[model samples]
Target: MAGNGGHLTPGLVNTRTHLFQAGLRGIGEGLGLLAWLSAVGEEAARLTPERAYATAAAAAAEALRSGTTTLVEHMWPHPSSEVHDAVLRALKDSDVRAVLCRGVADRADPSRRWGFDPRLMQPLEAALAHTDELIAQARGSRVDVGVAVPNPRCLTPKGMGAVRAYAEGRATLARHGVGVSYNPLSNMRLGSGIAPVPEMLEAGLSVGLGVDRAASNDTQDILEALRIGAYLQRAVHRKADLFGFPEMFAMAAGGANRMLGIEENPDGGVRAGTRADLVLHRFDRDHACLPVRDPGATLLTCGSSRTVAAVLVGGEVLVRDGEHVRLPSREPAAGLARRGSCGG
Candidate 1:
């Protein structure tokens, strides 16, 4: 019999991440959300298209290597078209499946109240036009362009109205169809109050997990987000098992597909005719070897990116033996500039 060295599971779908923040980690460690904004927002404002491209490359490589086969990147806008192009190029060059959400903040006035730079805001019309252009360019590509309203409060009523109108016309680009990436940890870390996950889920909306800004979470690991998300809810409700493995696993695995507006795969993930996104973790060794009594419990409590041994997406082996095998190169964005924006 051929022996398998690890546990096979669905490859995680990270619902949200600001890949550009990968380069801005640990900037405002002890500051609250407001103060952190002034420090970090300044860095965000200074990002050039070239820098954004480099950051996306570093982030894409990190996510793929860590067993995340599908990533939903919520990008903050840089004034340059090249920055957005850089992201597409990185994703294409890396060959990691992704949904690139173009985040827009039409009104930085509210952000200004928090001491953030006003320069970070893009005009509402320009933002929509850009998103439309990107979506048209992304047609038939693995990358999909979606609209992201970074913060509802950040926009004026007029700006909000504009977003609503633009979103209606671009309904196909909504996250997972009719869904939103909830980032409770990032919110709490910034003292931004917990996201209304319970409320949103109850309203019949498809809610998915997200790590939000890399600088906020300080790591791109989805296991950390899943565990922390469950813990926070439990602590809030005063119940030890307010959430369970099945719910969290679904969010990390097939939840995004709900928003993709695709039909459910009833044959099971490993069965024929189903999508081939999967991951293997080496649970037979080290810390992950704590116990196999309950696979879900073991996974949530002990698993981290370090335990990842392999990953497969759409039947392609992108990671093998804990190493990224299918990336364009070990170095980030090697010769990627020549590709010129990946068509979107």
Candidate 2:
């Protein structure tokens, strides 16, 4: 790989996303968070199982093309088991490692004033039972299951306690510690407040980069996320040296693995004994990325899907020369267009 003047590094781990929103991209462009949720919820209510499968597959492929090996999908509340199954199947078929967080909202609020949309809510017991079924189905696959609440307002007191107990019983959060997914693009797009990354780092927290859902960020490009994440902190603090390339790269790659309980190469880097989830990039391929004095800086600033020559997950070559091995480049986009939806 070095013979061709290419750089090899660990693939990025997207800590949060909503893959189903691939079809809903560009729907609520200028709306605030609450208004945007209402707008997205209307379209989300119309999502069918086939649409879910197509959108999820398309979104996962987009993430992979941008050098994301693992994605954490935080689905919103929906009563359809078929829709959830379709999303899982799509991720499995795309061959990307994923944690499918089944969304649950116990509180019902018809008006967008206080709580989650009642149309998307299901009984807590039923949601838990369905999640168990999903776990059983995903046992031997590359996908995992977890619980997701849109926000604190979405959960009742009893629901919170039940979710807390369930999470504690299933995973060792206390042992591994907590992590934060710093989604700068999503926050900026939604007009949400900036995350105090420097302070978080000073306090010794593991922070990772996330493109979030395509609906909010409109892209799954981790390179862009890394660049924006660093620039945002620098702009807010008026300090150009706030976050160097190495720290930003770590956050993009494997900084949140401990929080996610990902045992494969917990501390992400190119090393022996780590899972071969890696990406190969050629700076010479892009004129803007040439003369790479610092590979990390070049990647964070000038890199895009065009610079990614190949991507490997678990030593398996899934993308070669910026194209997926098993999926046609146009299939995902065509699938969305067929359903009368546009890509973000």
Candidate 3:
């Protein structure tokens, strides 16, 4: 059989990434969440205004190449709606499947913030409406538009609720609900407190896992993200296993499908008949290293992006032997930030 070499496989659920900032991975030592954001490179600022598409596309290529099939981007500070659509198209340019979860960021008091873009409430409101309309329009089509509420530290409690309400409303459109994705790390890094994830779930919201961007996380590990979410829930509810491995697995795999609001027969375990988003990686060699017998434990603790060998998105092989097969973009966005764009 095929050993070191691999075959097309299921991909990961990368529900929260800045896409444009995909190049931003390693630059400084992260003491904690807050300290990491303080060290982010300056290239993020330049990605806005006119160069958003290139950035987003670069992120898609990075994820697609890394065996990530279902990518949900949360691109905030976008120049305009045209830029948002352009970025979405860029994600599709690759063989990997993508969900454009458009993110919006602004402050209640525009004057207090630093060099901050004025909280264009009307535009944001219009954009939210536009996302809903687009998702509906894209029914039964490839490349759908999902909604995302960007970093909440920029807003108050009312703002967080607004995000939740909008996401919940959007989820109900499909048979199962909406495909919801987010990054609490970005929010936490920006001094945003723990998201009311338990509250969001209580309110009938469908949420999923995401790794924000390399710039924010310093390192992108979905397993660590799952632990972060589970830890937060335990701290909040005082229950250790309220959100256990099974729930975490569901969140990682089916969360996007839930956000898509697609219905199923409930017997599939990453099987066929679902919108194709799968990743195949080399784990057998690594499995014997620790001398553990259970594969699930090995995957949860020992696994990282390095294990991924190939990825299939929408039945398309984006990553073969850990390489992206097709990407329409020329190259990663150009810049000076060592993290965001492959410039410096």
Which candidate gets the maximum lDDT versus the true structure?
2
Local distance difference test scores for all models: 0.70, 0.85, 0.57
- In model 1, state the lDDT of residue 300: 78
Per-residue CA lDDT of model 3 for 1-344, tens digit only, reads 23344333345576777765555555444445434443442444344433555556666666665555666666665435665666766766664556667665545333323222343333556767667765665556456676655455555566556666776565453344443465656555555567777677677777777877867664455646655666676777899767775666566665555545443212214665666776665665355425545545555556555666666766666666555666523455352233434333
Candidates sorted on lDDT, descending: 2, 1, 3
Clashes of each: 2, 0, 14
RMSD of each: 4.9, 2.2, 5.9
Give residue 250's error in model 1 in angstroms: 1.2
Cand. 2 TM to true fold: 0.95
* lDDT tens readout by residue for model 2, 1-344: 24277888899999999998888778789998988988888878878898899899989999998899998999988988898999999998899988888998898886656678998888998998898898888999888888888888888899999888777778533335568899999999999899998888789888888999988999888888989999999999999987777888888888787777675444456787877888999888789998889998898889988898899999998888888887767988787886443212
Error of 2 at 8 (Å): 0.2
Question: What ranges in model 2 sit over 4 Å off?
Answer: 1-3, 172-176, 264-267, 339-344
Candidate 3, poorest ten consecutive residues by summed lDDT? 335-344
- Worst-scoring 10-residue span by lDDT in model 2: 335-344
